[model samples]
Target: MLRSVLAVALLCWGADGAVTCRNENDEPVNWYILYKAPHLTSQALTGLEYVYIDSNVMRKMAPSTDNYKDIKHPNGVLANTLRPLLTPIRSMPNNFGFISYSDQPPGCNAMDTFGHSKGVVMVDNSGPGVWLLHSTPQFPFRRDQNHFWPESGARNAQIFICVTLGYSQFSHIGMHLQYIGAFPFEHDIPLDFHQELRDAVNWVKSPPPNNLRKLISTDVNQPFYSIAKQQSEQPKVGDLYVTIAQLLDSDLQVQTWGCQRDRKPSYCVSGIHKVLNIKDIHTVLGNWQPKHDHSKWCVAENPNNHWTCIADVNRATTQYQRRGGALCFQNQRIKRIFLQVAQGTDDCSTLNIMDTIDCEPDPHTPSLMG
Candidate 1:
């Protein structure tokens, strides 16, 4: 019943044609997650494959594709990077705002200190649009220029997750940016004039909030949290986490369980099956077809527990010093993908490992320290 309702909503929403995400082929997608595999994959074309997943059920884990349909301009994300900007003011929902920020914002230098989070936020005045988060640096290109991926960023595997949501939920997102101290870049899109938007923008410039927060992105069915290093309470929500090593926050005194944020093992996650990419690196991505790729994600080994998440930072070193975060959910299809592709860890030499009955530590993570 719920699935049917969501399907109907998606159809109506897609038909509106107010916004469309350009995929690898420059084809419009209701939403899509593209994983630009790094060179470590086991296949020949091996390191490169794009995973396209959208709101439409038929497109679920469609196929492994590297061939792009557009080159004259950036497709996937770069092409439709400024959908909100294109909206006719008269056609905008009662309230609509698409806000974008980057340390390396177009027409400006990258802000040295800012949230490590990178993505697009487009919500109707009443609240309906997708938040596109990705690991690509110097991307989304310039709003006016043709979108193109930087050669520097192309070598590493990158991931993108586009989740669409209704309006009310953005208030929580506003609160998150407040906690992360994410400021609106010089090129930032003006947020809604409403109080909630004001609060988010103000929080970017003000002092810290009282404590940590756990909020859910209802549209995507994923829950996200932020733990400020300055706060007294420790990072603890008790769920498995995942991200890449380069983006880890290393400035803090991060605890080591068994799964280390970086490869050092000095920062370990004691018992849980800290998913690794050490083995065959080949798994069923879609149609259960064998595909090799470099995408960071997590899944509870216990199937019934069903905790699957796709993220950017690895629990590696120096991440504590930087602001970082990840969001997870209990969805069945998302769970299967992460779980099937999960790689188990091998014994490490650098970090000290103490055996304990418990492996899964209370959910604690170091995130954007605004």
Candidate 2:
């Protein structure tokens, strides 16, 4: 089984030396989630299929499975939790630290205004760390390109969660990547760590007075929560799943990038809290649509509100006028595995009597309306 999960993750390396989040049987984990599955039909599409869960199989709730895995399986679990930042920075450990943002970064050219976000944080200056929020776009490929995974992220469906916090939760994940203006093509953050990780590696030339920020994970006593937003040209009082359904008071369903362009529809608006929008997913490696999933997430439609986010914008209206955030938590087994892969949505009485709803495009996605 992938070489016995890389021989029990190399016999649980450095036992308590920190830096974790490895499970796919590779052990160590305080959190984990990964979905990946997309590339629907081109025959044997090698988009490195996936599906995994952790925190000890969500404390034994586990069951969902299509039996996938292959994210460059050299003892997978994303290559054994990115083999110590793809090794060789002089054999590492001068109290390491890292960052790796992305707005489609890899070889570069796609940062428009930044903050569509993607992550990788690392850290370990004597305390622990791992944070890996994601939605993939030219991913994990620039630690001198020692490569970890990415072939243009194998066409669509993506999602990742990671989390293992510590070193003072990376200064609230470097001020939530400087309130999401995140575009650090690569980073190292060392000068004795936290200056909000050198202001999130120079948030695209400085800019974090906050368009939104929220924190709460108290350095991994764990209950995680983080929000971040910024990418404005105007339009920001609410959007980001209506401020995550009024800050987790519940009611949300979301899932994003469903054939972009203007999108937004399904926020039932009456007294707040109700974000809907999903529209067929049914996973276990099967059903699709939503133009072949580009995975942004949400969940917490009551059932005693066990929240669960994992975002990077895309309810679209030009992504709520741009920029993004999300990384909530309050797991009820990760909110029933993202509420059983949703199934359908877009209600609100069909958008309160329709005024335009067409969607269904994906001729291999491109035109987000100029």
Clashes of each: 47, 0
Model 2 poorest 10 in a row by lDDT = 352-361
Lowest lDDT sum, 10 consecutive residues, model 1, at 246-255
Q: Pick the candidate with the highest lDDT.
A: 2
| TM-score of model number 2 | 0.32
- What TM-score would you give candidate 1 relative to the actual structure? 0.62
Model 2 residue-pair collision total: 0
Predicted candidate 2 versus true structure: per-residue lDDT over 257-341, tens digit per residue: 6666566678776787778888877765566656566778889888887888898877766655556688887867778877888
What TM-score against the true fold does each predicted structure earn? 0.62, 0.32
Candidate 2: clashing pairs of residues: none
For residue 310, model 2's alpha carbon misses the true position, in angstroms, by: 5.9
- Candidate 1: tens digits of C-alpha lDDT, residues 142-238: 4443434444344344567765555666676666555444545522233544455566545353333434355544434455443332221111221
Give the runs in model 2 whose Cα sits over 4 Å from its true position.
1-34, 37-74, 85-91, 98-120, 123-131, 134-158, 161-173, 177-191, 198-239, 243-253, 256-265, 268-276, 282-284, 288-344, 350-370
